[model samples]
Target chain A: MKILIGISSKKYSEPTLDVGMRIASILKSSTTILDVGGKINEFSYKDVSIANELMESWDLDRPGVEVLEWAYNYLIREKYIEKNLNEIGFSKNLLVDKGNGRSEVFLKGVAVKNLSLILRNGDIIEELRDEVQSFEYDLTIIGGSGKRSMAHDLIQYIDSSIFVVNNFNLKQKYRILLAVDDSPGTSKVVKFGVRVAQAFNIEVDLITISKDGDFSEKFRIASSRAEKMMRRSGVTAKVKFSEGELVNTLVDIAGDNHIIIMGTSSQSALTKFFLGSKPLDVMESCNCPMLIVK
Target chain B: MFGFSERSLTTILFWVTRKKWLILSFLLSISFFYFPTPDGLSSEGHRTLIIVLVALSLIVSETIPLPAVAILILIMEVVLGVDTPDGVASSFMSDAVFFIMGSLMLAVSIVHQGLDKRLALLVINITGNKTWRIVMGFVTISALLSSFIGEHTVGAMMLPVALALIRNAGLDTGKATKLSSVLLFSIAYGCAIGSIGTPSGGGRNAIMIGYLAEFGMAEISYLDWIKMTYPMLILEIPIVSLILWKTFTPSQKTMDSSVRKLKVQVAKTGKLNANQLMAIGIFILVFLGWIFFSPIFGLGIVALSGVFLYLSFGLINWKEINRNTNWGVILLFGSAISLGIQMKETGAALWVAGQTLTYLEIIFQDVEIVRWFVSVVVTGLLTNLLSSAATVAVLGPIVLDMGGNPVITGFMTSIASAFAYLTVVASPTCMIIHSTGLITSADYFKAGWKLFIISVILLLIISLFYWPLLSL
Candidate 1:
């Protein structure tokens, strides 16, 4: 499996890098880290510096010269490629021929690749969106500063699956929550969540929230089915039901270092999901990482 | 509808879920037409009552969106011959409505400038590690800003600060600790209380002010309004802090780690830029104008000029303002004002007040204090269900027509309308806090009833002590 991590310029997020390492190592996945210089790079290339520092810290014996050299050259080549593309009446997008392709590094026995690309003063969010779609990534993880805009922008365009992590702790036992309901997307959400859980070797809890206990029977059936699906995938599973609004219930259930994989197209959440309402609502308050699957 | 085939079952459920409100609306409209007209009311007044009954029912039930319910009121008023198009149009565009529109625009512009980061720095700087102190910091900052900048904006800005504190607290919402409740409730309740402190605090204040002027009262100046209300706010802040502190007593004493993280979070926000400085300057200028010159220019014109300055100074663009400003809320306010004006014009308000006043007068025997209590209760109850502005628009007219002190009645109704402590849908501030996804509607009910009772007691105490001294 292939994992994609987009590291931003926000410092003091070493925990995000650690989170990426855990996910890659557990799934035995080939992970690619794209350290894109965001809006903060205009004043300073602090994003590149942080990426280099984290890379060197991750692998002490592997002299960091090769990674830094590759990263610097990649930045230079990216600029030249963009100018060449503009000269041919073909505007440059980060999706194709973007990033420093030569920059690749390994992190603690995990096959890690680092691409230091600068979006440089344009719509960095849009540029990053295209860059993420270039790979058929099974899981795309992005570092954030616990701001609503960072998670909201990435969640708006979900190609396959995405995780927006903020202030993640380095040493923590991650809890996995599968937020399922009777939506068209639930089956996909359940199967994908279970597969990821099995890969990460984590216990999965299936939670369904009903408003005023009106959907107890339906939630029971849904959680039961989800539990069976997870069990078949060789992942430990538990089924639970509570009654409240969906987003609020999830917020109440989420613990530290927990990853919430939610199905947005449920009966109560369908309309709000289309409006880009519930995901951001949950993200703004939920202290843990979120993997929203459509 | 039960025991049906798959497609038939789907069709049945669809109708029951989606179209039930439409059916209820139709039945309600037909039912109200048959409602008996009250005594001493014109035929036009009776028709207005029918429209009011339907509109209020739909709004309370939430069968349709609220603004749509308000628009339907406007449409039905014309269709039922309660008022003419020209009269309705003029009523819809009052100075009070313009003030609401302009204040909402100013709020959106202020929030868009990213000044909340600066506010967060100030709040966290004051609240270093002590859990109780942090709670007070949030309350103090929110109360101070919401008095001038409006409650909804302050609520929206202060919401992230509280949430960040919760995250740093490492307290899980699943456990639902008293500490968490203390933090979240402080922001919501602070915004609610502060909204009553100044003329610009909320549209309901301006609505009451405008109503008093139109109903043969001296135009209450901005400073005059502040003198009447700020003392009550001064009394309210500590009382509110005590209420929340006692209701949700924290299990632990200190939040050392969370406090440290808060300091770091404040430091991380960096410095304010030019746009933020200009936004703050514009806001201060507007606030000062409201304090000094609103009596001369009137509050609405002064507020409108501030929004014009926000535009001309390039602090915020028209598109951002247009996007952030809720036109639906403005439409709802306008239509509500139009309906309120109609209720006053056709003697609907007087007739309604007359019917209720008969019973109260029999009990109180012309006692002004007892009549004021009834007015406050009625306004408070209605405010819980409707927006404060809508509550003031509807009930302000009826109570002012009740023939007591118009200024006192206006003040009472406006303050009581902000007594929306019970429901998540009670006020804009409550709604914004609930959007944080931390507190549930049930949690609201749990804490709300207590605050409601406390707020009632506080209002009466102020009425007893301050109202007489100020001759309000």
Candidate 2:
């Protein structure tokens, strides 16, 4: 397995990138560090000058030279550190952007390299529509800071996998709750849930809510699908289904569960995720932690 | 459909007719004179009044979208032989709307660039997490921004900040309802204070300056306005903060001691992006221009300059800037201003004022004492009920008719205008806050009454004692 960890040329990105590289090394996977340049366009140099002039005219506090120097050093460290990692018989590469140029860093060991697109906000999603469009990662290992909204966004985007290192000292076996719907995504969801169940020696309970009614037939189909996924993955699991309001039903079913895991299409954020008539209804009603997989 | 029985409809109609009896009577009298007789309302001069009122209601009720309403109003004007379509259209796109559009673009850019959040967070950090501290923080920031920017912009800016804090803290959304209500009203209060700090803070402030010039009192510069108002704001901050804290917060003192966590979160917030920084710069420049450059360049010019600069720089596009402006509020402002003009021009306001004074004399039997007391109470309460501009317009000429000095009239009117201190829906601040969907109108009414009482008393103190001392 391999991963591509992108880093910005800022001091803040240093600690996060270091942690990412360490996790990749532990997982025995090749890690590529992508160094994103500050120059977003050809006129970036002139843009900086004009930015300073405008700031001064407005009597704003100007960006100091020290910060600029730190940015440059951080970019340099990306290449040097990757070389050091490569020396340890680990597959490591540094991808740097020449000023105002575009580039890509591929996860080479993956079966499909074109699963996701890395573009800025306004980039046309349609341009990459044909790409099977999975998460950028098969699984992402993150440190204990679960508070960052951006990290939450990245996890949802990939819908790959997430491993949250919690505050508890123990390498605890996580209790998993899988909320399933009749979609292709459910197959991947069940497989992932079963792998987790087997690995942690925890039982898996699959609950499918019949939002459209007539749950008996749909439940049988979902149960068979879960069994088939488990059989293929060489794991045994239990499945059941019930019917009610979506959010209320899910929350009630997830009582005392360690986490509520579900997936959304890429580009969901905190606000859009919580928007509804009773937007906070589920969060207020739910007792256990929610791990929303986008 | 939710079944509304005929019996229920009849009951509702009975109640509505009973409550609206006075308005019904007035409407009946007008219709009886104008419609059936054709001799009742003189069509000679009242044509302008009739044309403007009908046009205004259509625009404000927004039964149709603004452009459609504007077109309809223009068409109706031509059909009614009131004016040409071109003249009506030109009137619809008034200078006030243009000024409002320019200001709205500036506000929207500030929001888009996320500068408003940064400024808000800076205030929150400085004030700490104590309930009183939070109130003080909101008041200080609102007052400062309202003074420099417009009150409406300050209200617009702080609302999102209050919501973001509530959501990020994982507190109950109910907490947001009251706190946001208070914050919005604070913004309105700040606007009131800030307007007095500068001539361009509001239309009323400019009118007050013009009145001062007419009286040859002083050339009240920006600094002079600030000098006069800042002391009052400083004195009132503690009182307002206390009232708000008492009203919204729980009685128990369970302080949020995770100060370090808040600090870390603040640190983690990414630095201002280039666009955001540019917007802040433009806002500050425009604000400074309003304060110091008023003698050379007018406020509208400086404001439009900032708007144009941001547009030319690609900080915001034409669509973004255009969409940022609220034409509804602008139209409302024009309508209010036009009503004020008509009230004075028609001799109706003065006649009504004379009748009110006569009634007051019959009740109190002392014209001077009754007049002064009536002036204080009526202006104060009306300020809370209506938009500050509308409140001032109604009260300004009334006080003038009572033979009070111009400065005293200006002082009392300005004080009343600031009385939106109590509720979230009373001012621009309240309107912005209410729009967040955090604070409902009901929430403001329930919890806001206590704060309203405090504000009313404070206004009384200022109007009776503070103004007399200052003006003397």
Candidate 3:
């Protein structure tokens, strides 16, 4: 089996890449590491100013390199420590594209004046679109740092099938909770999550949270629709419904669950306050690994 | 149990607060007929309360049409004895309303001519496929059209195209919505900056111009307005584009070489869009007329000429033209303007202005500085909260009455007038964008706060240096 792991060049990249490469080796699957960065022409003075500030704060020597170099170093160091995957079984090649590609050496090689160039949103999207369209990986692993802000909001806006990585010990048995919403995007998530559940032979429970009173009608209707989706995916999932408050219901359902998968949709600032912030609140409270699929 | 009980109580409380306007209106009607407020409380406070309650009542009714809601507010104001019948009737014809109506009509003509699309396409094409470049292109183009044509029209023209591109890219609908939302916000923000570029971009600009007309020496011609505004558009758009792109780029790579290649490929598809080209020519001609010819000729007459030419040339049919014009918006403009005029006529705005200075004297001490501070902060926040035109309509007379310096007031109003970046519903362009499922109300508020902060800094710079030096 081929599994592709994608990580950003920031703080969480090393641990995520190490963990991912280790798991790929144990499974004896071919692993590919993709590091995302601003293209050479894509950087800008504004971006350099921001990047330099962050780099200075992090005590990193290379402040003006492509974003991919940070992730590449993590992957290389982890490979040296193990000598297990890179040696006998698993193959490692630094995948770099003309657009969305990144490498530690090349990133470190960049100068401050050159950092002002940055790629377009469409280019970044196109790079990912081409990479995903070409690759036939069974699963695409994503390394997400929990720092919440406008940056996370931006990432969520560009890619929807994201898996936020967090540290938690695996149990003998896994309890997976999928919080379904009314959006059509939920259908893709249900189909994807079911496949993962079946692969692990884990029991999957589908849940929907409705607001109290009249608005609950939308949730009740959505819950029935979600049930049909789960059944169609060939998963005999248990369906649950609740009302009262989003945070309370989410926290209660999260209890004892191995992993909780929730869908975050694109919302206006007002609705995001009402909708998107719940997952962040849940992430803070729940010890269980929570995955927010945007 | 506690959580459940507390949740139920809170839900009940929310429901009550949401429905309070209806409850308050009912109680007020009873008090007016049955109990009545004491004569001591019968002054402007209760009348203002009634107006506020009545407006809230209109907003609360989902089943009622907005026009019907406005009618209800009018009726309640009359019945509740807030305004005399003559006063109420006359309140519908405020200067703000006239300015907004005339400006929107001109904007619709531009829209009908297909000018907005042509300009938008030109910008996107020039930017190539570079992500930041495309964003800058979209922002700049949208800003130019919106500033000259009308912000809402720019949003209407660009949103569909942006959405179509995302869909064509074979991207996720949710992600597409996010990017589209950012694009929409940028369009709105850009239009806002652009509106200040010309006296006719928005009603408020015209209102400020009208107020300055009385000053004789306080001159701000169309070309001069453009000169002042274009620099602001240039300054903010790149930063907005960078911030938007940096904040929204996905975690997993979705963009590839094909996407960049696709941008080049998309240009080939641009050939068949001739209506888009005609639209561009008509838009530029009208824009030129507005900037250059209108000052020598009459603005309304020149604007109507463009409308006639577009119609006669079959650039837009009557049906397309009518639907494109937002009559509801026209009514809102009229109603707000009338209210503003009434306030001016009643010397209410002057009274408010006097009270405002008294407070400013205590805080600011220096009258000239207070005047500058007042013009920047009040105009900025009010225009951001309300419609820019409405802010001008209501506040224009008051600013004029301040009698310190017409140039200072004019520059302040113009600068503050462009500061509608706080909420999605604050401006017509915002509403147009918010309605398009591309951007959510929360998305605007989230990014808008930052933009608002930047705008404040920009306003401070303008008031502190740009105005004092430029006006002199």
Which one is best on lDDT? 1
CAPRI-style grade of the A/B interface in model 2: incorrect
Please state the CAPRI-style docking class of candidate 3.
Answer: incorrect
Score every model by TM-score. Answer: 0.62, 0.50, 0.53
Query: What tens digits encode model 3's per-residue C-alpha lDDT throughout A176-253?
Result: 788877776676667656655654556777887668534456666766776776677666788877675876777777
Which stretches of model 3 miss by more than 4 angstroms?
A1-294, B1-19, B22-99, B102-121, B168-170, B176-184, B211-220, B249-281, B292-301, B366-374, B432-442
- State how far residue A65 of model 2 sits from its true place (Å): 44
Model 1: per-residue Cα lDDT over B1-472, one tens digit each? 2456533543344344444665676787777677776569988888877767776666666656666876898898889898888878888887788788888889877877766657767887787777777788877777878888888778767766665666677864323577767777888788888888899999989888888887667588787788888877777777777777877888767877876776776677578878788888888888898888887777877888889999999988998777567677788788888888788888998998887788776887875855576668878888877778878888888888888677877888898887878876677777655533446677777767777777778888887688778764
> What local lDDT does model 1 show for residue A11?
41
The predicted structure with the larger lDDT, 2 or 3, is 3
Against the true structure, whose DockQ is highest?
A: 1
C-alpha DockQ of every model: 0.03, 0.01, 0.02
Best model number under TM-score: 1
* Candidate 3 true-interface contact recovery: 0.00
**Residue by residue across B1-472, what tens digits does model 3's lDDT show?**
3445432543444345445656676676556445453343434434544454454344433223345545665675567555787877777754435545555555555544333334435655576555556666777777776667666666655654454445445653233355565556666777777666666676677666655653364656677776666667677777677666665553323433424444554454456356656655766777677777766664555566666667777777777556445556566555554455545554555666777787998988987767766677787777655557656756776777677766667667766777777765466666545433346556766767777777768766765666555654
* lDDT for position A135 in model 2: 25
Each prediction's whole-model lDDT (CA) = 0.69, 0.50, 0.56
Two-way DockQ contest, 1 vs 3, winner? 1
